[model samples]
Target: MRRRDLLASAALPLPAWASAAPERVLRVGTDIAEVGFDPPRVSDRTSVTINAHIFESPLTYDYLARPALLRPQTAAALPEASENFTRWVFTLQPGIFFADDPAFGGKPRELVAADYVYSIKRFFDPRIPTEHLFHFENAGILGLSELRQRALKAKTGLDYDAPVAGLRALDRYRFEIRLARPAPRFVQLFAVPGLTGALAREVVEHYDDELPAHPVGTGPFMLQRWRRGSQVRLVRNPRFREQHFDSLATDLNAEDQALLKRLQGRRLPLVDAVEVNVILEEQPRWLAFHGGEIDVLELPPTLAPAVMPGGRLAPYLAQRGVQARAQVDASVRHTFFNCEDPDIGGLQPERVALRRAIALAYDNTEELRSVFKGQGVPAQSMLVPAVYGFDATLRSAAGSGDMARARALLDTYGYRDVDRDGWREHPDGRSLTLRLAGLSDSRQRAINELWLKKMRLLGLRIVFEPGQFGELIKNSLAGTLQMWSYSWTTSQPDGDFFLALGYGPNAGQANDARLVLPAFDRAYEKQRALPDGPERLAAMRAANRLMLAYQPYLPHFHALRVDLSQPGVEGYRRHPFTRDWWRYTAKE
Candidate 1:
């Protein structure tokens, strides 16, 4: 059977219990300040940390792991981008009512196609400072650049009088957008992590003259209050819609076999309130989860072993009557090399050889077993283990670790012990010395130490260039640092997307290694051009070979995600790459 067919065929079976339940209140704890509630502002991790309470996308994923259109109007009906990848159309869901807001002294108007267009435009708005615009690069909407320019003007048009970019309101219930490609998943892009509730065009217009303080979005919860650097709070938009895509809960799937079957005609929500609090340090969260002050914990590293099945917290978790899960997520955690920096010595082939040598010398297995407690699998190649075909032959090409062989590569490249002393020297006449900058995290520090030790053994001088994390990030990205070990995360299921593979234009700057091969560039571009899945996979296999052949990066560990819910709070499942929603979630 075809893979996608096998995947789709494994749907959930019918449930026996069927009963309407009340709303649910979910409380989650965090450890830092998030950028803000507005989706287009900054891709701040802390802010989007809480789900259900704020920010909703149009379509969402289902328990079976398929992209389930959340808006009733979108179900089984959204249009596909044409064969040339240039257009898409969608019908607005009907009979939907925004939760009535007494705070408005009135009711919100019915959602329309115009709202979707405006929400999309907000991302391109320069004033928004969207740190993650790559999500929309392939959107291929015409006149989008002009719209972005208008949105970016110091003071500009915040509302649409007429239509642009082939965008038009075909009456109040339907909308269309012409694209530059035959985007198969274009409509589903709305279901990805980037979309948010429609903002009030008037609210943005009112604040156009000044910087936006509090942007309004239509979701289950509204920004009730924000105390900068301290805490932010959201109250149930008594006048809101029960949107399942509320950003906080957007990526976390809420699944219950019995609840799903029982919810056919049932009204959603079992609890009255959902609260999110910011607690920045790990200790308070550890205490709170035990005290039952928070229903869900993001599972920090120190806490990973205890509540997890294998580590120190295993005994405690069992005694506490908690359920456990270890997700081998697609998030490929890796160490990035600053290949372009001149200070790291020559921008050409010299640096490439040294970088490749460093990648080979380190043992990934020891790091996983000792530091990550055998939880991480080696990133022999780019694609995550289960999502795509990893092509074992390609993985085998990574070549086992041989310190002597690695030294020979450096020697071949003219890096040899000229002084006849222990340390090697650059053939260009410079000493073989390099400084590595690393993060303060215990796990990261450990990795850095391992690399330093291995490099030292291979006849090189190594140093740890430490500083405040904020400055470390600044210097690292700007390429002032020679070597770095940092964490890269993702929620995308397929390695074919721009995140892991695509190069040139959103090929992903966060790659940290910042190396782009001509071969990879060709393969990435070709893979997307193919309309068939099998063909795309074939190109990706070739691309994966090109990526691993050089070994630009060494993969470390997977993000460990765990959920702890009180007895009354049921129905929380780990969300896969496509961020899922939670309207059907209920409490006993």
Candidate 2:
């Protein structure tokens, strides 16, 4: 597709009443573009945000609850777990039917246990090539990995017709999963939209390789229209199962409580439609929200000062009756050094020292102050708030830059300006330059400039390779990038979720850095096997300290997420993990 076409929404004819007051539409503006709607194939945040509305998982986190509470979605109730935690059985709620599609041969197909079994197996199918397969692979699900291997060697691809022993449909509504070992946290994995949403077999077979373009699910909304990379529109599913606003004892403020009271007893999916515009630039997105073209806006860090000066609502915005909410986001941004590269990789003493020195020289506080405009706190470690094993007392050795120490370490490692041109050369006297990949945005450019200034002070040369966020992720996964800046937002509240990024087995998957350390890998395994308690906490702490010593990633800031909504909009709550807020939102 042409660039212009990819960046433009289709100009559909508007209804006669489209311009009338307060249409039941919740419009959203997001800076990042989506990859596609395919649940199993997509891993980006933008795509996941869109898909969350179209798909329903067996379980989900409570929408209004703080500290996140798990609740059943398609499942009749929580799964019955065995004493050893090796087996789990779930019963689906009756009368849940998929959205009407030609794949179903003009018949209404009720969601069944077999559909979930088929959906999850697609993650392991080589034909689909899902990046999230590692989540299930590490769960030690009996016979699943073996089944995938068998399909890989067979002439035909994954046999959706065949069944695996671990994933069995006990009846029309009930299914059981048997694991090789105890996975107490396995149930939480289902709450992730892309990881465990139900997929109809006929729909998969009908679309085949084109499944990304044709997503059919049994959620509150259906993808009515999509102009890839530019815009997406979702209409309420007429056949959606009847679900109401469930109550929870949350720490909601008076305003939040008032909004919830107005929404109580109302059937879910209060809005008639949802419209999302993909505005790549933050300025345009903010402007769209300001001009009343969009109902809700996520205030970017670069514009936080103008929107919410001094961490409070700006006077102009407050006078316009805009409500703003700001909280520390459950995420971490960092730059990763590819462990597979010869220049920056490996556990050698010199390489380790060089990496640690670079980390020490990068000033996170400056980035937060200037780039973020005081919208975030300097991250002490990889662990973000709300996740287990995040030690408030623990601090990173490289949190503050130590220029004197950084220079001494480089000089001792033979990385010196041999030619006296004010630039350092490799220990072997070869021309040395570090390449860092980043998005071609003003904010990223500013960040790159900061890094360049720091590197220049140390007599080192660094270059920024600009590309789209999708391209950067592709290159990182391929292990072609030497160093790159990225962020990870946990879908579940587990320390293992972040620590698993350094595991050797997850290379090119979750471990984008391609780190391979046996000691760290062992620690990760030990922590995953234990239940959430002191034992697991101790193991995770050791693993985190080991990563800190290795210095593969320079810990960055955990910025506060700022959200703005017009006063007319109601029942719009921000979730820490799930992004499916459109269903509960409505405009007066």
The candidate 2 region of ten consecutive residues with least summed lDDT is 6-15
Runs in model 2 with CA error above 4 Å?
1-23, 154-156
Q: Output the lDDT of residue 364, model 2.
A: 89
lDDT of each: 0.56, 0.83
Task: Estimate the TM-score of every prediction.
Answer: 0.78, 0.95
Tens digits of per-residue lDDT, candidate 2, 1-588, equal 643353243233344444564558888888888888789777778789878888888999887787789889999899999958889999999999998887999999999999888888888887775667888888877788888888888845777667677898999999999888888889988888788888898998896766676678898887767777788888777678998986584798797788778888889888878889999888888889999999898888888877777778999889999988778888998889888888888898888888888988888888888777877778877888988889999878675777899999998988888888888887888877889999888888888988998999877899989987777777887899999887888889777778988888888887887889999999989888898889999999999988889987887988788889987988776788777888888788
- Total backbone clashes of candidate 2, pairs 3 or more residues apart or in separate chains: 0
The local lDDT score (0 to 100) that residue 562 gets in candidate 2 is 84
RMSD (CA, angstroms), candidate 1: 9.4
Error of 2 at 462 (Å): 1.0
RMSD of 2: 2.6
> Model 1 shows how many backbone clashes?
28
